[model samples]
Target chain A: MTAVAQPEPARRRTASPLARAWAFVRRNAISVFGVLALVYLLLPIVVVIVFSFNDPAGRYNYTWEGFTTEHWTNPFGPPGLGDAMEASLKVAGLATLAATILGTLAALALVRYHFRGRGATNLLIFIPLAAPEIVLGASLLTLFLNWGVSTGFWTIVIAHIMFCISFVVVTVRARLVGFDRHLEEAAMDLGANEYVTFWKVTLPLIAPGILAGALLAFSLSIDDFVITNFNSGTTVTFPLYVWGSARLGVPPEVNVIGTMIFGVAIAIMLANVLFQWRRTPKGAQ
Target chain B: MTFFHRHRWLTPYVLLAPALAWLVLFFVVPLFWLSITSLQEGTVQVGYTFTWAWENYSNAIREYHTQFFRALLYAGIATVVALLISYPLAYWIAFRGGRWKNVLLLCIIAPFFVTYLIRTLAWQNILSDNGFVLDVLKTIGLVADDGRLLATSTAVVAGITYNFLPFMALPLYVSLEQIDRSLIEAAEDLYASSAKAFLRVTLPLSMPGVIAGTLLTFIPAAGDFINAQLLGTPNQYMIGNVIQSKFLVITDYGQAAALSVLVMAVILVLIAVYTRLLGTERLAG
Candidate 1:
């Protein structure tokens, strides 16, 4: 099928100067642009990392002087950004876990069901996707206040779960659509019940997509600023802390945090790519 | 699968139950309350009560409408910019790049794997007073001796475009990749030039992605507060900032809720029209 589709274009590749130019552009454009775009994306991040060693006064007119770990080692520094960092990690960790579990469950339900109001249910899931973060944060805040719930970790977790579940549902549901039902049927035929069939058969197949979705959720929850800021009360996630610090000009310590997070994300994405490569058929390669 | 077959009516509902319940309780119910609150006029001192005030919407319509349209306008422009930047890159990755495609794709998404706030704030340092870009510009005589790029509306737009470019690119890549190569070859075989072939065949097929990417970028961009707050001054405030202020700082639930509903309704209508035009009967699905 691919042979038939690509034949004439493949043939023309050798003939037309225009085709050769197009091919050359297509071949080199991404690598050229990829490097440029990557630099564009990473330059700011690199500046942050480089300037973290600079003094607080150096923040505005930053320069790479001799290195100092003063900011890093400042346990009792002004504003205690370290405390804010710790608080951010804790909030993000809790939010990640809570969102993952709820989102995964919601994904399972959406995939397995064909019930009434399914259309409405689908719409509801996506509504949050398009929801203004400020509006969501505010609405959640009001709901919490009305219920007398305090603005803290629990509220942040709840809000994160609210927004993050849509991602899991969307991701896992797409995987589920392509997944064959016969595997579960075959498992059932071998005396597995519904729960067993789901646990042993379905879960294994959908686990990757679920993990990917959860990772996306984790990143989103941790990265969230608008919603977290609105509902956080005294709680300060990394983003909120960064926002506050930006007021007095962003602290160099925030750069250290950004660098650490970026490093971890890069490492994980690299692993994901390697894993996907390994998963593809060797014969196909 | 057999159990579902035997109990067909029960299956979908059961699958949909948890998500539906959560959506109704959290999303739909809160929206109902928001709508109700919008129609009422009362400060927190008086406690919110329905005066059936049509004036709040009218007042907001007259006063905040400019900001609302400005936000929409900015988002639209940003979305288009992102699309323009992303489409060629996406096309290169999808059709031209070979085995390096996945690696390049990984790189494109790598930035997003980190927290949004960090990435946005990173730009602060890069575009700050005599920062890297500023230093380069100054060296090139683009800015005066004491000029800065950090707080400008252009920086906000650039920041938004930089961040959302991936969202626009990925969907387009997916749609473009899904398109059969034969159609393009056929267009060429029929005596169409490379450019004409792309215009006739490639563009239409990728429209779905373009629509999805546009909606994805525009919706969030319109509602984004963090960008405006962090990157721009008071004059650059978007409707999302207003919503945040109304709901959080002021506790003006009626106006906040009203604005939320209005934005939500507008987005939904746009999405509906978009899907209809695209002939995607089950858009989210």
Candidate 2:
């Protein structure tokens, strides 16, 4: 009280260390929270990976018993696992190919041209994404029932493609929008035909976008359950197999496969990120 | 030399034809078919007929109002939780992150690439009665020994939040990343506190992402039944479970179709109100 702010000065000089520490905490609190949120996001994944090594005493792989690598070594030793994997791969491959081709073309048109029904096309592309997937599954099933089309492997593929096309279009369109049109114009001016220009210039430029879209479609189709469950009459995809088994009991093999999928997916994603970083200029990063 | 130059107006149509045909046959037509089926009397063995059964809607609303309310409430809560968690995370990745942004973002999303079913099942294990989560909670006197998380609404909502968190994070990241850094600097220059600058400047700019992310999370979460099926008891059953069982188990096609239509309508109305309340012109621009 002797000075105007002797207490404040003394506190800052000596006893304000606790307050300084709190100020530091307050400043970086959001960053710590962010990383903690990420850790929370990864917790279940960690659990899935951890249980892959668990040797369950019972049929249900709920409690931890002992550690074993048997499931990892023989992932498909469980009955129906091979069939489920094959069905999933076959459907995912076919749907991704078809959806990518169709969606790339649609994305190009939507981005490059001033056309009739452009707004309508945008709305149409958006509606599938906006609608609940249950509605899509129910609606498609109803159509199939009315038309008497048998539901099975092909039906699952059809349903996957139907839902995936919208996602593909959006992904490709995002890439298409950012690209410079001058490059394509230069190609055309350099005595390149339309087909050659597309194959040589435009296609290469849009290839990454197409690849990303294809990857997205593949994952969506492979991991789909609710829609697949409705459209698949007896076709047991990996998710369907998992669902059926979960009702009774789940094998450790499921965790093994899940861990493998997660690992492979991460590898692919990191590679893609590397590829993008290389393609973009050094200045951007 | 030019595809668009030669074909002029016809080019866009040609590009769009395949996707449009597929969407029309599988998506648009199926939805129309669903509406007709919703009005028809239906049975699995007897075959459905066009009998104008409006009672299907009335009966669904009367019979399943609680399930509807439960689904909406669970999804709503999950969306808010996801937003709260994602905002800080996305903000950090966008601004505070240096060269590690892409790597950090990839790590955050890598877990989601695992099969959806297996991950949800992982949640079942994580929240099991005698699991570490419960042990810690009980140790801290936060949970009674007899009060379990599994087979409860809490488990179901947690599953929803985990499953849809990435959907919220990605969009929020995109928006937060696109903000101009200089604007925040300008606010600081005007003697605004860090928190005030963030609240006044950063938050307003990120509203579009908030809208997009919330819609993406809420719409899918509301329609998802796997979480309820795997993690919660019958008491926590959602409308998705009701609709799924109706279509698959009971084969009450008309009522399921009606429920689908009603759910779609309600979601659409909700989206309209949401975008209106937030003012969509800003989002669109």
Candidate 3:
């Protein structure tokens, strides 16, 4: 302990007052600016949420005309948001499942083994991550046309999966790097088969990473507009619907949908924070 | 070599199979198909025959020179702006936020969870002629009585920057947080000024973040179609907008594919140079 304590006084003496002030400012700035930035980030979302309850003529300036549940209750009215919401959820859910499975499998393979062309394979996987989404979307469209496959839900799902898989692989790979391989090896040594060892030991260890990746995938799929717009013929996700509607002046109900989605995301993120906090070492927290 | 003893040969390939298969099927094959489509001369209707035309590339460059170049310019500017704005926030969050770090981090990420389209559309409400932002600006006499923020290239660029700021911040934060505190303290103890220490030590250590964040923000912003479509008219349309119009409205697959291939090539080159310069190990972290 004495060996580490020797340089402390010298370090303090040499530090300048300006440097000390800068350090103080640097440290506290996140909390200060974080509050401002947080407010900036959430302002639009909060405004949208609040305006969702306004009367139908809440266009330029939103005045609270008492309260109206008309948007949520009568979702199938003139501006039927229900259909779009349902479609978005269905597409996002399916895409999430497909991407998660594919991504997890790919991650496991890359992390656990070294193969010929591993470098090339790594590049290929990350290519999707780095590729401009517009290029990817256009390429997929062209490929589909050349193969004579009409654009539909399947095409959208496939496109979503293509992008989402990379995220899954990237997230899971990070977890796998710090992972101890000994547990699986020990399981195999104790008469467990390869599959059993993986199932019993490896799967549980990587489950949190998988969940994080899956949540990310789900959000990406839900929030996608460009690729989904390209592939869906007459189909519309919530974003697409919102975009189309904004051309004719945005209805207040769209704000309601936005608010609901924002609320759900906040809930999920808060839960994630709590879950992580519980899992963290007490000292670290 | 004993075949039975060399189970390593099988293990690596087995582990890598799924990822390799996915990359080949979705990414590589699709890219090759797009390339082939680009080389063809005709539209999709007359059954695009192989023509091996190099004219498409030159034509794309000739016809959309301004839009293409403008897209790149906007992307570059937005990326730089986001980086400039995000660095201090990311730096504070990473090195100095203390116990509120994770909570603040969540706040940074929370905006991303909302549907991107909705967020941008909300900006419309804020920036509309009689909207809050415009009203505030007018009150301070920043514009004429009719000055508007929407339907302009600046709005599209600003929107892109606003949405993508987190991508820049997170990667930068990750890189900055990974920096050793001892290095900074060591410089201080050696009687180096804070500004000197930051320039010599902090900036160099954070190069990986700058590279990754720039790539992450710039690539997407370059090809962003929705921002132009929603916020700006034909004059502000980007390369991505052109690609979409070609494939969907114009039904010009050859031109679309050619455009896509050009972007893919450009991005790939960027990635190669970036990875080479920054080294993937650092950026990947």
Candidate 4:
């Protein structure tokens, strides 16, 4: 298939130098732009990594100074940074777990069965995604306040779960919609009970989707700022910490943490990719 | 257990129970509460009352109309910029990336894992008055002697463009990748130039992605306050900033709820009009 799709070298060989050059440019323009776009996206990330090693002369790590491993060596040296990170991790961990469980079940029901209010359920799931984060945050804040519940870590977690559930549902549902139900039926026909079929077959089929959804929920919860800001009272997540300190001067430790996160995420993604690669035949790729 | 097996219809509802309950409790209820809160009258000191103060909406618009328009304008520009940058990138990955496609896609999303606040902060360093970017611009005389990049509307818009670029790219890639290669090849077989083939076949086919990407980019960017808050001054403040302050700092629940409702309402209307303009039939998965 690739061989058939390949351009004819004979036609290209007959072209004049200028025409060939123009054709090359025209053919590769999109790829060139893609590379440039990737560079644009990574520019700030590179800056973060570089600055993480810098021994800044002042509180703000904006200016470059002599290179040092101080920030990396003691990432939690900055006051409030560790606390904020702990808060963020706590919220993300809890939110991801809840969202994943609820969302996986919802996705299963949505995809595997026909039920009343299914259309409404689908539409309801989309509303949070379409609605602005500010509105979600504000509405939740109002609900908490009206109920006389103080805004704090719990409020942030609730807000995070509210928004994160929609994404989890969407992600898991996409995977479920493409799933082959024959396998589950086959397992049942082979004398497996319904629970056994679900545990041994259906769950395995959807595990990747659930895992992806959980990762997304975690990232969303951890990276969230807008929604977290409105609901959080005195509690500070990492983003809130950065927001507060930005006016003063952000410490280099923030950059160190950022770099570490980037590194970890990339490592996980690479592992997933390599796993997928190993599962597929080389020629198929 | 026998009763449960006999009533097969109950199973899906059971599966969906927890998720639907959570969504209803947290999302739907708060939305209703937000609407009521928007109509309430009072400050945090006196506590809010359900006086049906419809004028809160008018007052919010009247007072913060500048911020409202500025938010839309900045978001619109950012969406357009992101689209312009992302289209070619998505096209390349879809049609030309071959086995490296997933890797390239991962690279695009990798920066997002670093945390939104930190990425924006890195931009602060990059676009600082005396930073490398501005220095180069000044040296090239594109900027005046005293001209700066940070704390300007440009920086805020750029920050938004940077943050939401992936949201634009991913959908576009999906749509582009799904295009039938045979259509383009058939066009070429009919003696059409490659550009003509692309314009007539590929461009028309990718409209769904374009619409989806634009909405995904624009909606969030419009509601985003962080970029404007972190990178721009008060003069560049968007509606999100105003809503944030009204909710958090000022504790003026009425106005904040009103503004939140207004933003959500406006976005919903815009999305409706946009989908209609693009044709709702194309939006279905």
Candidate 5:
């Protein structure tokens, strides 16, 4: 500790004010840049939220006219916006559930057990992650066409699940890698059956990870445009609706939906953080 | 229960079966099916037959080479921009955020929960000819009287960087957060300046995150069409736009499949080389 401490005073003593100022600038540059970067990230979302209440005279909401609550009062004023939102929600829900289950199981198998095809399985899972969305979407379209199956709701769900599963596996597996396996062994040693031990001991510990993965899958599915575009045929997800409307003129209700989704997501995330903080012992932190 | 306990080797396989089957049927088979479809010859209306048409690959490369190159160039620029914008924010969140670290990280990610199309469309408003950004730029003499921000390659790249910034930031934050402060202290103790210490000690340690972040940003950006479609004119369209138009607008499945396969192959080879150059061991973290 002394050796570590010695350099600071000595450097301070030798350094001039200009040098000290330079050092301070160097030290704080990242933090400053970080704040600016955060602002850049939030800029578009802010536009969306602010524009949600803007009552444009024309169909295009690109320019703000004046503030009004008309859009919020009739949030589904757009022709197909409500249906598209419903389709997106349904797809996101089903895809998240399926991806979470499959991913958690794969993660368990990969982390808890060693087998012959383990490396192959890992590679297989990663292929989807590394592949571009365009390729995945196009290829899936081709597959459906060749198989004599048309693209629609089921096809969108399948496509969402396919890409989403890989993400779920990656996120859940990261969590599992840090987990302590001895708890499971201890549970079993206490005369609990394997099923009971897994259910009681392992499942609860990894539940947060699973939930996080599911949230990620849900968001990815809901926001997805490329894959859904290819496999959606006549089906219109929220993103598809937005794309179609952009050519004509985007409605203010689209901004309303965007703001609502953002609000709900932020609320849930804050709640999670608050819950975690409350649960953790002060000393542990 | 007895039979399950006795045949424990089958447990992993049984657990993995559902996901493995799902991936094999949807993911792996589609990749093979894509490759086969790429080799077929015909239009969507006429129907395709497999004659091992290798020319499709060459034709895709030959015909749309400009779009392919543009896609790579745009994605490359966007990745670099994202890295530049994300690294400092990630570093600050990792090291300087203190008790608010989780919240800061959440802020970086919060904007993503909104629909992607809406976010991109928001860019349309922000960069409009009479928008505040352009007005400011025009007043500052950074932009000419008639110069516009929209319908340009720069707008497309900016949108790509904004949309994918979180992917770069999160991985970087993960790796940077794991770095021990003691190691940095030790470097200072050894008489290294802060900048030198960061370059020698901190930078090298974060290479894995850098590679991961870059790949995460670059891969998706390369295939992204929404930014180009929404922000830029046809001149700025990427390979994704071309593939999307082929599959949906023109209904040329054969060419679309070929282009998709080519893109996938190129990305795979690039990733392989990247992993080899960076050393795959670092990625295990």
Candidate 6:
């Protein structure tokens, strides 16, 4: 607590009024600037949420028409939006599942063992992340085109898992690196085999990281545009649908879905944070 | 040794195999194919062939240098602006948010839950020709009565900065939050002015996050096509837009592949420099 507390008294004894005002501005500048920046960052979100209720007179919901709750009650806006949203969910769900499982396994291997070619494997996992989305998309498209595999829903899922596994591995590896190995050793001493010790102890401890990684994977897959845009031959995910509609003046239903996603994500994250906060005592680690 | 120790040497490899195989098939193989495609002579109708054509690389650069430069310039400026905008916000949350730090961080991230296309589209509406932002600028004499805000470089840059601000903010927050406040206090205690203390201690210590944030912001921002497509005119189109049109519209696979490889190579080189500057362990940690 004293980290910031003890410094307050040092600035109070300034002599002149000008100096005092200067000091005040200096002290408060970062805080004011920060809040304003946050507002700028969130302005679009406020617009999106508020606009969800708009009863636009036209196809596009660009201008604010008088407020109405019509859009929120209608899950599908225009013609194909509901289907697109469903497709997005399906792809994200499958990709997240496959990526999480693969990534968790890889993270376990990386953290728990010293092996030949481990360094190469680490680089391989990292390369997808470091590569730009546009480049990755185009390359993948080229591969698919050359390989005679038509691009669509399955290609989107494959690409999502490809990019997402890196993030999952990175997240889970961080958790694993911080793990208390002694607990596992203690379990072994208590006559538990490796599998029993893992299921009973390690998995439970790292479960939060796994969940976090899965959530991250889902958000990324669902929100993806560039990569999905490339490989989606006639397949329309939510973002792709939005992009296509933007040319024709987007429907208010887009904003409705946007708001719903925002609300759900925030709720899940808050609940997770609360759960973790309750689980850990201060400085227990 | 436990039961698993009977084949301990194989355990890690077995665990890693599935994910590794997935990466190899979807990620590594695609990139290899991209490399081959880059040197091929191609027309989608006629079917492409490997012809050792290197002009695809040179011609893309010569043809689209304007877009390439614009992409670099836009991404570079956006990275700087995002850093400047996010640093104080992140600093405030880290040092002063205290009991509200997690909540503050969540607020910072909340906007991103909205679909990316929607978020960009929201900006498009807000800065529409007759919308709030332009009206304000017009009223304040920042823009002419007939001058438009949308379809300009400023709008494009601002959109990029706003979209990537969270990427910049979160890493900066993590680095700033991890700083030992006692170190800052010690500098103050030694009679160094607050500004001097911050410059010599706080800024340098947070370089890893700053570097990481810049890379995160720049790479994606450079590769971004939606912002320019939605908010700006043909004049504002970036390299990403060009590459997209090449692959999908123009159907110039070889040129697109070469351009993708070039961009990836450039990004890889930048990352190598950054990694060297950060030192490998700092990046790993």
The residue pairs found clashing in candidate 1 are A113-B12, A114-B12, A115-B12, A115-B13
Report residue B87 deviation for candidate 2 (angstroms): 0.8
lDDT of 4 by residue, A1-285 (tens): 364367865545555688668768976876778788889899999999999999989777878789999888899987888999999999999999999999889888899899899999999898889888888888888899889999999999988888988899999999998999889889988999998988999888889999999999999999999899988989999999989988899888888898988898899999998888788777674
Candidate 6 chain A weakest ten by summed lDDT: A6-15
Rank list by TM-score:
4, 5, 6, 2, 3, 1
Considering just chain B, what TM-score does every model have? Answer: 0.91, 0.96, 0.92, 0.97, 0.97, 0.95
Error of 3 at B170 (Å): 0.8
Among these predictions, the greatest TM-score belongs to 4
Ranking by DockQ: 4, 6, 5, 2, 3, 1
TM-score of each: 0.89, 0.94, 0.91, 0.96, 0.95, 0.95
DockQ computed for model 3 against the true two-chain complex using alpha carbons: 0.54
DockQ of each: 0.48, 0.55, 0.54, 0.71, 0.65, 0.69
Question: How would you encode candidate 2's per-residue C-alpha lDDT over A1-285 as one tens digit per residue?
Answer: 112112344334543567578647865997889879988989989989999999998898888899999998899998999899999999999999999999999999999989889999998999999888898999999899889999999999999998999999999999999989898889889999778988999999999899999999998898899899999999899999999999888999999989888888999999977877778776554
Chain A of candidate 2 gets a TM-score of 0.89
| DockQ winner | 4
Residue-wise C-alpha lDDT for candidate 2, range B1-285, written one tens digit per residue? 375687688988999999988999999999998999899985777788888899999999999999999999999999999999999999888877766788889977876788999999999999998689999999899988788999999999999999999999999999998888777766755766566888999998999889999999999999989999999988999999999999999999898999998888999999999989885776654
User: Which residue pairs of candidate 5 clash?
Assistant: none
lDDT for position B121 in model 6: 92
State which candidate, 5 or 6, has the greater lDDT: 6
lDDT of 5 by residue, B134-206 (tens): 9999999999999999999999999999999999999899889888778887786677877898998888889
CAPRI-style docking class of model 1 based on DockQ: acceptable
Clashing residue pairs, candidate 2?
none
Instruction: Give the per-residue lDDT of model 6 (tens digit) for A175-278.
Output: 88899999999999999987899899999999988998999999999999999999999999999999898898888889889899999999998997687677
Cα lDDT tens digits, model 3, A238-263, are 88788788767677777777777778
**lDDT at position B198, candidate 4:** 84
- TM-score of the second chain of model 4 compared to its true counterpart: 0.97
Model 4 TM-score is 0.96
Q: What residue pairs are clashing in model 3?
A: none
Question: Candidate 5, which CAPRI tier?
Answer: medium
